[model samples]
Target chain A: MPKLLEISKPFIVLVEGKDDAEMLYSLTHSMGMPKDEFQVLQYGGKQKFPSFLKQITNFPEFEMVTKLAIFRDADENSQSAFQSIEHHLKSSDLIPQDSVPTHSGEVKKSDSGFAVGIYITPDCSNKGALETLLLDSLTSEMKSEIETYVTQAEKSLSTDRARDKYKNSTKSRTYAYSALFENASFHDTFNKRLWDWSHPTFNQLKTFLQAF
Target chain B: MPLVQSVHFSNYRNFTDFTMDGLQRINLIVGDSNVGKTGLLEGLVTLWGNEEQFKALPNTFRMSYGDYTTSLDSFWSWLHPQRNHSLTMILRSTDIDNLMRAVRYEDHVRYDRDSVERSLQKTPYKINILPIGIGNYEFQVDLFNQLANTKNGKESLVSSLQVIEPRLKGLDYLKLPSSNHAMVYADVDLDYKIPTTQFGHGFTRSMEMLSNLILSGSDIMIADEIENGIHYSALGSVWKAIIDYAVKNDVQVFATTHSRECIAAAHEAMSEQENYELNVIRLQNRKGEVVAINHNKEDIETAFDLGLPLR
Candidate 1:
């Protein structure tokens, strides 16, 4: 939790929503770090990313924040998503010039003396969101079974019905993940309690956050 | 200007050992209920060395509880939950020789400035203390009468009254023939004059507050729940008047508020004035120990921008 105070922190991570904030919070706890050492702020939504960036950078806390990381969903394309965040950073003058990370999980330090990192959901390998990333965390045996169930479920419905029901690839993947948690709500699947941080799928995100 | 730049307290109320530095001209103490916001104000009033305020402590507590039967021992019970401990407060200011200390003993409390004990016999030194709380109509009316007798006092009172009620034309005290005490009256029209009671709490509270500020005359003002009885719309102008008067008279103000509108209005008022400092101190109960989170102007402004609830 990021408190509104004059105290300085070594770094702060900005996420798009509550689920992302909770997951990252649990991840840091599992890594044996004190909760107060770093702060995680929920910036409300993807569209609010720019405004939040501008605010935090201009805020008095900016002097104390040595590193600032942003985490958002890749949605359909990781490159475009990364570009969108880069534009905000550039426009806010957090970074002097626009430069893409040569490799995934690379950290970029802006001209403002703050280390900046951008992590898109689904672990950089997939062109999807957090639900897509969680689906990748499933065991190979469980993955096969879920894929079979989703394929059969799609076939059972009419094409128009399937298109309306599933909508995007991430939606079906989210349903598949939800089914594993006793048919929990869509948000419950992303709960920190449901996450298995040891899974290889989260290694990239873990490394990137730990670098801060 | 004698501004209290920092305060440290030990074994006082909820605070076992708490210290806050970098206080400004106008400090708005805000936090959750029962976080010792009022206790901090009481501690300042105690240290500011006014016998009237010191003696009024018991009455203030009784008024808060709405029980006049409350004992003075109950007031002393605020000296830390642990027994046999002295409550100590150290207030430092910009002037090197202006530091003051207040200590509460088992039997009595002592106030000292520059290592000299403050005598109650003295003509209540230049540091005038005005504490504005609920239900102080009689005291306010007396002060109002004193101010009305002075050449400029009447004009100042009318001007301050018009801040809350623009139709307020004149203000005077009406002494009743049946009783020794006098009641406050507001002249809103030429043919009609209404008692202060009829004008409502907002008007009376505003009049009491502004009168006290003007009469305080280059001293510290302590107001608990400063926004009480005032409309949200009038907060901006009221704050502007407070800041302007405080600046002109070299009066330092310490007030508490649970209203976001009040804090916002104060920030707006302070920002418009040049070279005036506003600090918002947030008290938090952390693991049974009170902590003061001090925010400078820039921090408070940013907190407002982000919609962080300082209260």
Candidate 2:
């Protein structure tokens, strides 16, 4: 019989919640690497970011995590969400793309060693559109809640001021989730799932470890 | 050259136990006459005699404490009229491994039949000669004891003549041609064989000092009252020669005296020369105790200008 391939690498997975941590754990277990070869940790939430940042910065393998993936729920308050999380990175001079000035020096002066991204369940077009999309879900109760939430988010996005605020809130949520995920991997496994839907690539997480 | 680095005594005189340190070729013992200055020198002479290799003198001479009384028991009556007398010494030498050894009294026998022993108020007199070098060859014969008020008590007072080796008997004596009379040897026994007693005290003292210098190999020479009979003109030359010998042989000197000329002589010897380190320990007798008043070259000059007695 042909032998099974083995992974002899130490990896860590960072996530925001125990649920996310368990989810990442399950994903990597099914992936090529054994669950034992990687570590996993959850930062709990954004409130712990500063302490987590300090704790992670001291790791000798801090720069080795190959990938630092972020996962956050994009609620309709973009600007508020950005405000809640942007201070730490701002002080570090990492101006987010949305906040950056067009001047070339601005980016050079403000870029920190981190990236930002957001995940949002796209908004329906009309008043009854969310309710119809909800019908496609297997759990009718969850579908209804999603429908209600999406409707509220869409209404909040209707005005430009509200829309910017919602976008910022969603962006902060994603940044917070990513920060949690990275901090978790710093404390535990590196090649584990980052969110319920996405796993941190071994190569990406390995970058944080500095050694493959 | 006759510097005494240190002196130790154990029953040699009134010093039941005494030591002298920071010695020089000239040492001043300037207290009341009875405070045991000459007695100390007598003890040193006895110690020198005990060492046969350096047999500067014969072991037959035992040191006796020179005080007013003829008997040891009556010494208290003559001096303090209250306290009994006993003395001990421990001399230190860099050349000797056992740096200190005691000089003690060795002959004591109890006789109840004797009339004096029966009437005695205190314990019978006992003299012990402490063993030096642990029973190795006449080590126990260094001390001579004089006990009082006993019929059998033998008065064994040996002369200080043993300070130097006994001359090959009769070698020091010469028969005069006229009547074949024999003349005693002098320190400077040149052609005329001038008896040391007939020679100038300075010459005789220098000769004696030179003989000691050759014998002791002492780094420190301490002469108490170095000006005893020294001539003023020869004083400077004598000091210079002594210092020269000390420097060449790695010796130091401590001398004490009440003579102003002697102080000037030492100053002249030291000031006009280099190489030999010099200091004077002026002694001040307060009440019944003697304490040193130390002075360096500058201090000595200042004190001299003030007409203060260095002794």
DockQ values of all predictions: 0.06, 0.00
Tens digit per residue, CA lDDT, model 2, B23-75: 54444344334556544544453443223321221121223354323433432
Interface Cα RMSD, each model: 9.2, 44.5
- Native-vs-model 2 lDDT? 0.39
TM-score of each: 0.56, 0.32
Report residue A211 deviation for candidate 1 (angstroms).
7.9
What interface Cα RMSD is found for model 2? 44.5
- Location of the lowest summed lDDT over 10 successive residues in candidate 2 chain B: B139-148
Tens digits of per-residue lDDT for model 2, A1-212: 12311212234443455544554455445444566765554444555544343333223244443323332222444344334344443443212334322221121111443333221111211122111211332245644554456456567566787766554233233333334454553214224443322313222322322222
Please write out the lDDT profile of model 1 over residues B119-185, one tens digit for every residue. 3232332444445444566777777887877779878878756755678888777776754867777
**What's the TM-score of chain A alone for every prediction?**
0.78, 0.37
Off by over 4 Å in 2: A1-212, B1-20, B43-212, B215-224, B251-256
